[model samples]
Every structure is written in C-alpha cells, then in structure tokens.
Target: MSEPVVGLVVSHATLAEGLVQSVRQIAGAEADALRALSNEGCGPEALQKSVRDALGDGPGIVFTDMPSGSCAFAARRLTLDRDDTAVVCGVNLPMLLDFVFHRDLPLPELVDRLVSKGKSAITGSCREVAGHGDRAAAG
Candidate 1:
C-alpha cells in the first residue's frame, strides 16, 4: 500500500492550530496524518523554515488560509522546487475534511481534488440550502 500523505496547515495567528484541532475532532484516528504551523509573530523566513522542517523529505500537502498572505507565500516558496509537495490556498473545514478522507491519493490528484473541493465548498447560504425558495425570498 502507498504511504499515507501528510497534511500541513499554515495560517496567520492561531488559525492553523485551531483548524488542525477541528480536523482532529472530526477526523478521529486519521488526525495523525496532519500537522499545523502558525505564523504568529514569526517572520517569513522563520515560517518557511518551520514548514520545511515539518515537511522534511516526505510527500505532503500544505493548506494556507489565504492565497495572498504570508502563510501561502511561505508554503509556495518552500514547495517550489519539490515535486512531492503541493500548496492549496483558501483552506476551509470542508477542504481539510476532504483531505483527511482522501490523503492516500497521489500528490497531483490529491491537490486537484482539494482545489476542487475547496472551491465547491464556498457557496452562498441560499445555494447551500437546497429548496430554499427563490433568491429574493431567501434574502
């Protein structure tokens, strides 16, 4: 069997830690497949080092809270030369949950799945609720 893919959550402040906690709460035994990194009071270089240290030489996915933020920047910088690493931005609970269930997929396929799932998970409240009547009524 293929080795299980590792997950790295990077975000500003305590967001990464909190997200990992939520993942652990929901994922149960599968939580060991993931780790979290916080950029709180840390410079870009420090953050990059931390992420690299967490990743080591293994295959993993880095989830960032924002596409244009430092966490994403660090993640991108660290994974640029590595084919075994992927960075997925705008991470939410749905995306992380998807990763927990599908981490065994190959790196490229897993990245694709995460990007798709993350984008699909963002929807207006009306759209999120099926049979919620007309948009005007919902508003």
Candidate 2:
C-alpha cells in the first residue's frame, strides 16, 4: 500500500488547533496524520519553521485559512522546494474530514479532491420561504 499523505493545518490564532481537535473528535484515531500550526505569536521565519517541523519530510497537504496570508506564505514556499507538498487554502471541516479518509490517494489527486470537497461544503440558500418574513436558510 502507498504511504498516506500527511495533513498540515496552518492558520491564525487557535483556528488550526481547533480544527485538528475537531477532526480528531469526529474521526478518532484515523485522523492522526493531520497536525496543526498557528501563527499566533510568531514571525515569518518562526511560522515557517513550525510549518516545516509539523510537515516533516513526508508528502503533505498544507491547508491554510486564507489564500493570501502568513499561513499560505509558509506553505507556498514548501512547494517550491518539494514536489510532494501541496497547498490548499481556505480549509473547512468538510475538507479535513474528506482528507483524513482519502490520504492514500496520490498527492496531486488528493489535493484536487480536498479543494473540491472544501468548495462543495460551502453551500447555503438564504431566501424567503414562501410566506415567511424572516430570512431562512435551507439546509
């Protein structure tokens, strides 16, 4: 069997930590491959080092909270040095959940799947439900 790709969640404040904790909650032991890093009180170099340390030397997918920020900056740098690493920004719970279950896929395919899953998870319908004055979102 192929080696499962690791997942690195990098974000501001405690977002990264919270996401990983929640993933562990829902996925249990299977979500062990995913780790979290935060730029709460660190500079660029420190954040970069933390990201590298969390990612190690294995093939990994770095999920950043935003497309343009410190988290993305650190992860994007890794891709230039290693082909096995990928950066997928704007992460969500659904994306991480999908990733934990599909880590065995090839790096490129896994990244693509993550992006799709993340985008798909962002769905909502806020409209007037026939006769309701208050705005309601359909689930």
Cα lDDT for residue 60, candidate 2: 91
Clashes of 2: 0
**TM-scores of the models, in the given order?**
0.85, 0.89
In candidate 2, stretches whose alpha carbon ends up further than 4 angstroms from where it belongs are: 129-139
Candidate 1 deviant stretches above 4 angstroms: 126-139
Q: Give me the overall lDDT of model 1.
A: 0.85
The CA lDDT at 75 in model 1 is: 93
The weakest ten consecutive residues by lDDT in model 2 span: 124-133
Best by lDDT: 2
lDDT of 1 by residue, 25-139 (tens): 9877365688988888889899899999986677889899999878999999987788889999888988888999998899899999989988877766545565654544432
Candidate 1, poorest ten consecutive residues by summed lDDT: 130-139
Assess each prediction's global lDDT (C-alpha) against the native.
0.85, 0.88
What is the TM-score of candidate 1? 0.85
